[model samples]
Target chain A: MRYAGPAGMDLEKMAVPLENICSQCDYKGTPDCREPECLMGFARRVLSYAVQKGLLDVPGASSLIPKGDFKHYYPEALVPALAETCRQCKECRDNHTPDCVVALVRSSVEYTVLSDSIPYPGSVFMYLARIKEQNPELAALLAGELSKKG
Target chain B: MGDGIFRQKNGMVAIDIVASCGVMTPEQLSGLARLSEECGVFRIKLSTRQTLVAVLDEKGAGRLVESLPGLGLKVSPYGNVVRAVKACAGSSALCPRAVGEALALGIEIQDKYLGMEVPKDFKIAVAGCLRGCTDPYCADLGIVSSGREVFDVSIGGFGGSSKPLHGEVVARRIKREDVFLLIDHVLNRFRALGEPGEKLGRAITRLGLTPFLPPAGVKEAQQAPPDDFVKFLED
Candidate 1:
């Protein structure tokens, strides 16, 4: 599917290695600075790369996530590649996490941050507008997780 | 990374390959493809300036550039050096409107001035005819060949998207043999008179085109067609 967000933002470049994604996602930081760095370490890596390249061209690329985490969110920061990877996962059939840990964990984590009722922290509305376009299944799973938790 | 080389955001170094008048043989293509695989590049991009660009991790760039066969690959890493010359190798039967070989002329220009520094990054293009598929008029200097042995020369073309401007013809119906002489004359004049950082187009605008015209008796001008670009589109 054709995904569009900030102009010139490459999804694969912004994505952390799949194996490295959730190391400490529970710590905090949706699209901004997360404490102790997550397993993926994408936010820090992307920012460092951008600063090194002098590449603050994206619309909201250079903006800093407010200090001290409190429902900090920017759904648009999620890598769209994760959705495509979920489609290829052989374990997701009939909707299960055996082969799709990323899908399950990403949604659950996003859902948790989406509300106190769920299990995570933080709140971001940009993902609501962008997730389905980037990856429908991930968005659906996150919604499903929210519905079940609520 | 040096003068002409720039580091990509992904930490890969982008190496620029100057194509001879945008022409490369299948052997060269296959060779480059093999090199790309060995060097672990993501993809090969065809740049508009008639050059091939490949991004490789910092460790692989030096090795890849070192292996390009002499003459088969000319890497012009950024800076004030002459960029590649773009051209349309006129299809004989398919495009009879073309009288001269734009590609051949482009190669000759490449040999003569591809590395010659003049003022700023001066661009040159050669088109088969008025169709100008290669955007001859948008270059710092350009040639549009019409008859089998004649071309019209234009200067001061700017290709920037923000301020695109078509060059004006300074001479019309120039002989094939004299093309190089005229180009040499233009460059010599530009260097002696142009500001260090000024682009050819901007310099022409500031200094005017009359002073830069081929000196008397060098190449005769036949009324030197008017700024036909603006008129052609508006018409």
Candidate 2:
């Protein structure tokens, strides 16, 4: 199937990157998504989340991640675990489970930032509390690991 | 000392070099390198708007801005003026997929309107095609090539803020010449209506797009929102 449009215009090639970037997402063609009018909105939101979480404080991580938080710094242990969730967010675009923990945390973090109810250190604790409320077993596992390190 | 030099939190001044469409001739590049060396500039940053930024002391900044014009480089205008026009390589031998001459249009726009005072910093971007490599959809005024020498004009797009907006397409498949007239209309309207320090996108958001759009666009805006319960009661 060919798009019989104007000359020297390969609509397919031009449209490929646009389509491929969000093709498998649930919001691929949603009106709210605006045909992916968002050039870097999701990425910005993710970076915002990382900033609020103090994820950029880890050594060697600052160079890779976008700068966000300037005041607070966190321990290095949080990086690998948070990165695993980011990997899930990147991969599970359309295959997201109904109660996906990563999605829940990401949405809650963004909402917290937007609402501006709680400040940073408090917001960090709130994110953890929300995670504990949603997935007690996962929270317990993380708590155990952190206690062991301490 | 010039408007192009902005003082930073670190007590250094950032000098803006208007590298139009991010293009610099080899001679200009060499001149910049020499100037940087002579003026005690330590770092140079490429701004997202296709301008080059050099960090230096206040005295060094004054010297650099003075020397830049000799290398055929212009300093970007500061404070509520149209800055450099951002553009992508359009329809050149290198970029065959482009539907129009984006760089040429960008140059024309910059020549005519750069440094023009408005209510705020007005940004314009041109893309050769739908690929939009230069992110034309995120400019105050955006021109995207729809066909050979034909353009789709959009207004009130913005980015680099907490809230970013995609410019809405107001004119579709218009001729190259009409673009300038459309831009003139938009800029005049924006200047008249916009508050000081308010971005064009914010103005459009605050006041509805009706003032900026054409008659057909106004009609579309009128028809877009569904009649609410309040309207029903009034009726």
Candidate 3:
């Protein structure tokens, strides 16, 4: 299963010590890995690592919700090694990735100020976007918390 | 926090490893790989401008930059500055088709002009022959070698913009020695004419190439190829 998101990468080859949430994703093995920062091409590498580590039959994507201790296992920013993916992307010419929290939050700050949405800041999408930009480390935590509400 | 080091969202710093003319020694490359491992960075990026980029913590970034000079590596200037010269492997006792000293001339240009402040980023490319492996035609200032001793200098080329344009020839069949003088004149003229935030290309487009061209007698006859060039071609 290929978990496609900012934190998604083969567990074995991962340089950082983040939890291998990608191994247990339901969307792992799906073809919808269009997210710019996701390492979708590492399926073989992940499988090899899984086999070696005996991490087969991992849980679904939902089971890995609310990744805790954002500081310890937060999705890292895209490194130059993965820059090839961005080089081939059309969106990167104009719109950067959501995981580019600093740039995104800085731009969103200007957007929020210019639109003057202070009077009617009721959009859930806007809230998530802001949170993701301001503190990507905690955005997943909030998402996990929100999922428990319904 | 300094030149060539950009702070990333993850509180890490990205460092640009300057490899002039896209060339790096084996020792330098090995040093870079070792640095990556020490910093816990597994990947080193090759930037479009022929430099390496690595991401690491602030402390590691500082140490890496400090150690770069020992490995014959340095950082490129960010923002509006003259970038490192781009050149093809021409006539370097290596490339057979090359008729000009591409690497030597590119190094000369880089030593003289790299990191000079400009209104916008300035690019320069040197091609050894008409094959234009360096794509000189698309740089802010371009030099194409017609022969070992002669060159064609073009100005105001622009690429990677919404309105990309090919530069116009300003000096035809100039001598090897005149290239630097012409560059000096171009930079001076650009500084004088360019408006704030205007690129050399945009300014040239609006003002015209007449301002950048060399004196009428300085350039050889436009229609005639130099005798040496014809001889080189025949051989």
Candidate 4:
């Protein structure tokens, strides 16, 4: 459940601004939506992940409905994805569908990164356990990572 | 002027990217190609570690470095650091005995230890199975998976020894869940107990490997994969 996080990060202080920033966002639920490339947004992304997984709920998001790409945040989106369906495949012509293998890999990467930032065992499991049913590979990875940190 | 910058013979700098473990997206590869063409850098080599041996002039390196985080690439130190985990044809459908995902585990190791100071050059390799395709036994720290949820962890088997020792297993039939914990504990112990600049195996040879195991013993380390790890692989 526990993992290493970025050094010198103030998780408690960052939580407030992160929730504030995401509450004002219009693109919060877009499928595989990336955090805008910046420090503040990155922290907000992790907090948003926490809130969505019922790990931590920011006070403001209680009012909004769960709309937009619902599958984007769960293992439901990883089942059909395969390495054969990579998004960056030079040879592949089909440009539709969320089954990109690379996207799945990226999600695994994001999951590991997010877990690392959370800094606790129960919390990391909170993320990995959520996706255990939909994608076992990520769960294995999360365990491996948690062990590494310990 | 930089700590990690390497001077090259071709009026270029060699920036070592040890964390990639040789996988890259087509878009990332294309972006690199464009960068090369634009900068006129002569060569890009994938080194033995399956990392980029990218050679670029100083100016070109600055440009490339700025864009690297965007592409999810990092340049880590080359020597006396925990080198990137060299993975083989394990963890995927390729190897029949895959008890673990070598790339995923390798990336985890890379993320945690890359460029961290070590006593001396340290090489690590992970194999999903015991076929030794990645030469785990020949590395400073070699890990070989032995079961659906078990791994064999060893230390000190570099080929350079006149009589190179096979990586002596510090812990055998370890649970996949505990592999990382064992590795972390063993490495930290090695750092503390080893002589200055000593290789991990040599240090283990002198101190004996018993002190590195979990207090509960190696037997405790063997178990089924975690529920999620199993589901990911089968369900």
Candidate 5:
């Protein structure tokens, strides 16, 4: 089924390596069973390839898997696995579950940071400094306070 | 209607009246509406199901309740008492899946819990089948028909400002004899551990079903009870 509004963007066109896509495809009936390291092996290789090609920014990426006593990250495993299969496929946009998760998280983060009025790190502080520079009385007070400060 | 003599913090002690279920008639309603006007109760709020709720000042509330029996109504709300129940017009009226009588069972449960206090508000909804036209899953306790004279009893369902979760069936194919006993078990269990302001669904979720189970080797306690409404029509 086609999702009309904001979900019209095609995600599968992003592309995954051919070898990785072949192994990840569940052609056999035992998709839910433990296939030793076959599934995880394919996932790790695909993620490495994406990072090496600079297609995915690893330093900025959030930790997809949780730490501690839990054995498996049941839902998070879907991220790389889905990204691999959807690579270069126009039909990726048709899949509701995976695409919706990424879209919602991105939208939420943007809404939280950009929509706030208070100053933040980097560019915002620079803008505040320029405003203070325009006000000579405030600037003199800051200069005197800095000279007298402990 | 006479002037009131006492007042309470919540409002005024306008009236106190009691009557059996099914005892009120149309003639009584007409008389009460007039008495309510005389007592100064200007409006009556019809509940979600089929119950009349009147809000009046102290004098009017007292007079309405006093004259209620003559008009065939009652004034009862609050406490752990089983309040009015909601049910859909079943097969007898206009539903296809009404194998069991929904309205009759609803009335039976209402009478059984009438005037009895529990730990919190207990709601009972009876639907002819799983279509849930009357919103069975929205009640704290619910009964949905599976077949003729057969029903699945569900517990811990509720609906309001927050979304409601559908209940799980603890028993199935319940016969009429065990209906009241099942209700008694649930009510007594709730009364034992339920804290003030906690609704029946919240209490059940907190305590779980282990406490409500029958003790080992008790034959009658082994199975869940049937709903009385279906039994009434079967008989």
Candidate 6:
């Protein structure tokens, strides 16, 4: 599964350590077979597994949280669904897994909740336009100067 | 950090240093331009080799060179660091005839030699193939691909201000493992007796290619047929 995000989405949090699964594979003790490429592939496979179970959120969604605080802004309903998925996945086992998808989702969700409390993008632009509108006298003087140059 | 900053005191000598070819990123160039302008520089020139040379009266030169790398662009004008290994934008991004990644290898050479002081400034170039979009004769060392996984490494080539013609084949159909070592040997020999301020081609002319020939057991020096040279990179 491909996880995509805009900001505040950390790829490191979704990654699992390859050493945990090394003992389970036949190539564990072989010097020739223990290549860096092979280890990197195993790590990628674990990420894919987490994505397949719908346990990870896309990267950009985490930025939706307000002020970097999750409790203040994330939707309440999404929290329980994320927790349930985390509890059911065996990939989240402490010893076998380096990272779990649930923890990542919870952190993202909390971030989103906090972000929701900030001013919307359009509102800031609107405020700037209002200030320009309020200064009509200064605007008229600037216009007069332009007309004189013309 | 020196007091002697190269700048145009009278502002009449409008010198424009251009960077034509190199591995510099766009942001790095933009920052360089801004910094140069701030230092009362006349103009920043971009060379055909993708290198950025800022033209200042001798005063601003020090500060510009010192600051550019912080923005990710390092000045490697005349000292070691594989002096501007030129490579065409090949099949990795563009170009239909490219059989292998010329830019990738060029980048590898650049990273490996970025700041290493050599006997003289050594230049290596990579072209997608014989089309020579990069003008193979212009580099001190040139690598042009023949086919899948094969490359032709040319030596004693150069271009731009005071152009010098490239010389005969030192090696042909070189594999990846041999390329780096071969280049290292070439550079090491050049550095051993290269006179200060002497260009690589000039140094080779003074020393002669016979002394730099590959060691015994390696293929003897012979003029490779154009077609055999074409497959040099593929083997």
lDDT of 4 by residue, A1-150 (tens): 764322222234434533453454556676534443322343344334433322221212211111222222332232222111121222222221112222222233344223322111223234456556555675565455444412
What tens-digit string does per-residue lDDT give for candidate 4 at B59-136? 778877777777677775666767777887565444422545666776677677666667777788888755567888
Q: Flag clash pairs in model 2.
A: none
The digit string of per-residue lDDT tens for model 6 on B133-180 reads 787767777777654455677677767566557655677656655667
Q: How many residue pairs clash in all the candidates, one count each?
A: 10, 0, 5, 6, 7, 46
lDDT by residue (B1-235, candidate 3, tens digit) is 1378888888888888787677877887888888777866635787767778898877777778888888888888877788878888775364543555777788789878988887778899998766677888899999987655668898888878787989888887687778887888888888888887788989988898888777544665323422432232223
Report model 3's TM-score to 2 decimal places: 0.55
How well is each residue in B53-77 modelled by candidate 1, as lDDT tens digits? 8888888887778877543986864
Candidate 4: Cα lDDT at B138: 90
Name the DockQ score for candidate 5: 0.01
The order by descending lDDT is 2, 3, 1, 4, 6, 5
lDDT values, one for every candidate: 0.58, 0.61, 0.58, 0.55, 0.48, 0.49
Report the C-alpha lDDT of model 2 over B1-235, residue by residue, as the tens digit. Answer: 1277788999998988887678788999999999999999989999988999999888787789888889989788887898789999775443544645778889889989999998989899999867687788899999987655567889999876998999999888776777887888899999999999999999999999989875432221111111221132122
Maximum-lDDT candidate: 2
The ten-residue window of minimal lDDT in model 6 chain B covers B225-234
In candidate 4, position A60 carries an lDDT of: 20
As for model 3, its CA RMSD to the true structure in angstroms is: 21.5
**Model 6 regions more than 4 Å off:** A1-150, B1-21, B24-26, B33-41, B56-63, B79-82, B118-120, B159-163, B193-208, B215-235
* Candidate 1 Cα misplacement greater than 4 A, ranges: A1-150, B1-3, B91-96, B220-235
Model 3's DockQ score: 0.01
TM-score per candidate for chain A alone: 0.28, 0.23, 0.21, 0.27, 0.18, 0.23
